[model samples]
Target: MYGSQPARTGRTTLLAVLLAPALALAGALVLLAAPAHAANAPRTSVNPVIFVHGQEGSAQQWQSQAKRFSSNGYRDDQLYVHEYDTSVATDDHAIAGLEALVDTVRARTGAAQVDILAHSRGTRVAHAYLAVPERAAEVAKYVNLDGRTAAAPPGGVPTLAIWSSLQPNGSIGGAVNVHEPQAGHTESATSAESFGHIYAFLRGRAPLTTRVLPELPTSVEIAGRALYFPQNTGLAGRLEVWRLDPATGARAGLLPQHVVRVGADGAFGPLAVNGRGHYELALVRSGERTNHFYFEPFERSDRFVRLLVSPPGGVADSIDACPGHTALTVVRAREWRADTEGDDRLRIGGSDVLNAAVSPRLRQILGLFVFDKGCDAVSHLDAALPPFDRIPFLTATDLHLPADAQARGTIPVTQTMRGTGGIEETIAVPNWPSDRHTVSLLFKDYADIPSGG
Candidate 1:
């Protein structure tokens, strides 16, 4: 039942043949007259959607789309990202993988069919699978994101073809072909507009809400990206939102009000916020807290807000001075060296220095000095040589430095009895900067300590 052409080459030629003036016009006319459906209509239960990524792509590619789906009421279990070694595997092998994935999803969800969405080279794998008689019946629908196929109505299932390039010739008989000429190939897979169309096609209705929410009624929406400094590239991690007490300006509770995973592109929520108040959004890696951003929701004039996670010492007054700084500002923990066996003491000209250190790369050292006496305060001291007496009893500095500065350097951490320990890091800096020219660094604790050094 599969098409006769060698998997890759024929689709392009077929597209050319199909794009005759008359057929193109017919397809356009059909697409224009398509009826619009109400998003709030009693929705039908949809089968799981299986996403296949392009060559050199990973399952992470689907993160934003998956969260978008989750925002629209689809559970995590209802979405499947089928990852494969596209470079090493043949089309047949990839199709076999897809087949197995589909079967597993079907059995787990107990749905009669699943919808398939494939991008770029992944279209070949989907087409190969759909061309098989047995597999054809298992898909309720298919979405072709910037991919070409010779046959109209690929797999004979209802199809929606979202194109980023020139309109394809000859319609896939009875399929909907959408032309998003402005979107890039990757954009077609991640854009909100594309998600709207996919949502409609898969659910047979429009989306009630295209953005993510905090599981509560919301009056405003917050959306933005996360990245690391110097390189200013997107970050993939978890975001925890906590509500604050307006009167005391303290966290209301230990549990987060909402949490969502940021995608590989660093794109995060259209997170729903209930009303104007104080909130703390924490960016964490794995489960370790890395950075905490505090803000008042009402202070924002617009529904959308932008947050830049600056590098340790590069949080200059303006973006120009910092250049490409996106590291998490601070790494904090309670009593980082409390019960350790050795005395880590820092002696600056005979007297014991308890708090802070000087990094040659930074102009200043910023940290929270936590004392054994049950009080904490933020201290901003010179990076070159912090005075012995000026240092606090216990301190945790949120160090910042220039984007191009050395990431691996020696910083001293000490207590009167504990002596001195050097905290060194071979920082894993991000490779690219976000549109905002910001990126973040994961905080590393002490590497080695030479007591009385």
Candidate 2:
């Protein structure tokens, strides 16, 4: 013992850091005035938000999030939630549940389009309905809450994916599924902790984006927790909040206050929004919607595979546009382009915006990543483009990686992801590629820190 009392403690700490969950601080809450134009907004809107739970979840999973909306002024007539199996043919289950929900929302809202907020298997379900000729007419907006179904997302609907961007280190029991590409399984709607952001999106408000991108800390330390969650239950709006704890992975009440920010983490990228603050979101791949922007720790001793949590704030579009080893490129966002295009043009983020460009070297990598986070991927950006070379995708194929191995797990989204219900998951095109040169896009995020003003 005389050799060292503190020395032994240091060894344990190192072991824990390597085997613990990573935590990042989220954005602070602030109040702001509603835009003046919001008052004159149209009445008959698209599909009302329909929350779909994952795995063994019940309708109660959405209770907390639904309450957040009600408290924030979202009408009850515009809110809905669904529960599906974590076991069985995920595709079949999604198709049946989604079709019914579409009919209900349409009849209830008396509107043709319905916005969708689907989680886990629900993502598959939502797209399945969109594939149905009778149902596509109902969805105007779709926000995939980390639902990883089939492969890619279908076209036509705008999407937003708040993904964790990290991999899971756990196993389905005790077997490690690392490199499986489908390892870190999480749902956008898994926790009651996401209520704040959920409500913000419903009414079209801006989510906080980090002013500074945080670098990974030198070491990580996760202490004080084990894991235990309810095995099976069916309540939708409130289970994740009232029953399960993301930190310890227990079934105890996870009070909203327990949600805290800790440790340095990855860069929370910016989002695009208009005067009303409704920004478009999409996933880099289709079914990958299962990746939550934040993954909470299931076991305090587990590192690398933290549980999925909501974004610390704002839009976290998983966009990596690099052409080759010579250069890295990011798709330029027209978010800040002057509206001389007209007031009708999509408004840029608030007054202060940054200007970043794509390196000419990376010009050949031009196809768009079907946003698992927003409206029809190609169509959304295409609508804004003047037209050029059009390359349709397989919804299940990746355009960037040709080797197939390096592109493992992540699927390339095409016009038709799969056949049946999968078609809805695949996006459709209204026009073909033109022979003209591809139009240039504006990029904002730069991994390389800006040198000066």
Candidate 3:
């Protein structure tokens, strides 16, 4: 989706034009001596890699690639992402930001030079910085992903240009150009083929493994998506991989064995598991360790497991009824408000509940839901909320009840004005029947009472 205008090039002379500069640049630069290590030691460490995103892209665009780099022993701090506003920002502005970022990364990692990987419009920013001899001197290598520039070496740095059939192939003089006929623009950023080329170009050898895997010996491997909901197309979060004690089935410790970012596409891992035992994988929100989906590996035997952020009971099964009997469906609703007062109610609930008073300066909402024993808690729902709804209101729907079931839903309303505290009351829907189709569990005095409940 972030592809740019294609550059025209001659197909017959593409190979010669592309490799010329890279070969010359390789000869011009003096090679550093390798560190002394055992023959079986891991590959020699390379310079830190700075990723530049394309137009309308954010640092999150490189999540999968970053994880891949991490799997190859690059520490989190050694990898950097240069995020900039591509829409209104000029190439000079981006170049300046990149220059500062590269200096910071070099200082932090103590690397003499850094490698760069840019995609689509990001190629413009990277090329601009490299065109300057002073700035380009800090770059060890440049990997262009599905982006085009003139058939010349970028700042005389060794370059590898990867092109997808979705865009016309282009070349850089003295650089290595690879064309993958099946890969799309975005796929060029996330695919294994792309990583293979990038790893070889930067490290001077093929990757031992193209996919992310655990360092320890493993009998089985788990791979799949970690989604917010079963129906959700994608999710963005951190997956904390923890080891489990086979005997007690308890988590080993607070520290994660390996922590990887789950991409917006929801794909997480081909994570290695040591043996047949229970393991816990949590989808913790970025920066907050406590707020997460903590659960055991759901699919033990299958190679691919889809870990969904669902309530205890399964939703689909709860809605499934006898052949002739119909299940009851309800619309779950809540009230949300945020303003500059001492009173702010934030309610977040599912199988767990979190109710707290937020700062008066921040706007917030309290979303609460209740379900019968056989019914699962609401996880996936439509976005539509009742009137005067703010931008970030929470809505949970598609909750169903079995025949002859009764449950109670509660909404605790509290408000504070000035220094004194306001009224606090619990609004409850007691003995709610499964025969009823719609249940409006709203905050007191906020929603209109429905007729014929």
Candidate 4:
């Protein structure tokens, strides 16, 4: 991992060192090397890509794929994301928003046509858009990502339909199809394999690199939105970017690196920072709970970083928020399957939270909200709470952990990958009190899957 400054050995680093031999044996540390001609290759006209996220998803769903596209020679300006309110019943409003977005991207990039990539419920909107001959005429190609099934490519646009484990037999009429057995619904859109197909179909050539390459200077520009979950509505707040200790997830400095005023649009950043650094994105609002977000690392410049937040007594108010304990939201794009072998295991504070009752394969849960369900100061790892389980792509569990009032104690979280020889990653975060602060963590979905894995 690259860091702006020398990073000291922390608990997570020590654990990784202990597993080095296993990682080496599994070849999990190997990365795809950039081709010699990739950077200097002849350029071609690239159409701007507009990504349509699924139900209950945000622009952040396309973050990794956008970086991958940039690494493969797509200009940052050529990537666009259309955000909509997924809770709405009909696609009429979303279609209008997308049509306007398409026009805007076309005008900005001066491209004759644009490529459209739609995942999950977004596919429904894309299908509606393409129903109009004029709209279809404006699209050069389309990617149907783990969403609906169709008899033919909508509007006869050249299409690539990627099916996840949930839809092994799904396909689009007259379109090339691929099935990824290891990927879940969201992973089908974010994984590198899916990117390869998308790039090849639109560019008419294989990508020179599939990896998210690190920036040349090791410093990257980051920008994003702080929006209400599902609604995609903006919130006015203060955004603080704080560098964290790589080992313990404690603040590296007493003060934050940058503080930006978030407007009603929920947009912030374009701030430059170390590409490989671990940092906490804290959203502060007057008389409201502060939401803190953490990611693995940024290998390149990212513009789609989303900080999904809600105010007190909002959509997320169902969770027990207490001063005596910390609330946690852990997420991974890949589905957690506990019924089969080669399944993922997530450990919070050294206890595995993934199990048959909590993370069954059929659930396809991507996010987990952890808290003291009844505020009885008891932890139950056996089953998911009904309220969270009813929510799309999300689940919750009761876990009691006394907060460190001073925020000095670290809550160690570890995830052992399904494949890649049990590759283990641990991120320790500060134990912030739940009443005033909430913590969220993001994990990568894919690793090298062996044959028949």
Cα miss at 82, model 4 (Å)? 0.8
lDDT of 1 by residue, 1-453 (tens): 011101111000000113458867765311111111222233346787888877544443465566556556564446666655543557776787788888877776678899999987888788888888789899999998877655577778889988863343423556787877644455567666788899998888886544422222233445555544322345677888778664433467879888989877566665656545556666777542355554433211121122334344532212222333322222211122222345233332122333334321011121232111111122233322223124321132223322334222222222232222343222222212122222322121122222110
Q: Write the per-residue lDDT of candidate 3 for residues 270-296, one digit (tens) a residue.
A: 576654344556666644322222222
- Per-residue alpha-carbon lDDT of model 2 for 74-136, expressed as tens digits? 444556654444445546755675667666666755767667776555666766666665566
Q: Residue 438: error of model 2 in Å? A: 63
Stronger candidate by TM-score (1 vs 2): 1
* TM-score of model 2 vs. true structure: 0.33
The C-alpha TM-scores of every prediction are 0.43, 0.33, 0.43, 0.88
List the candidate 4 regions with Cα displacement exceeding 4 Å: 1-44, 311-315, 447-453
lDDT string for model 4 (154-209, tens) is 99999999999989899998999989987888889988888888898988988765
In model 3, which residue pairs have backbone atoms overlapping below 3 Å?
18-174, 18-175, 19-174, 20-174, 21-174, 22-174, 338-363, 347-366, 347-367
What TM-score does candidate 1 reach?
0.43
Preferred candidate (lDDT higher): 2 or 3 = 3
Error of 4 at 18 (Å): 31
**What is the lDDT for 313 in model 3?**
46
Top-scoring candidate (lDDT): 4
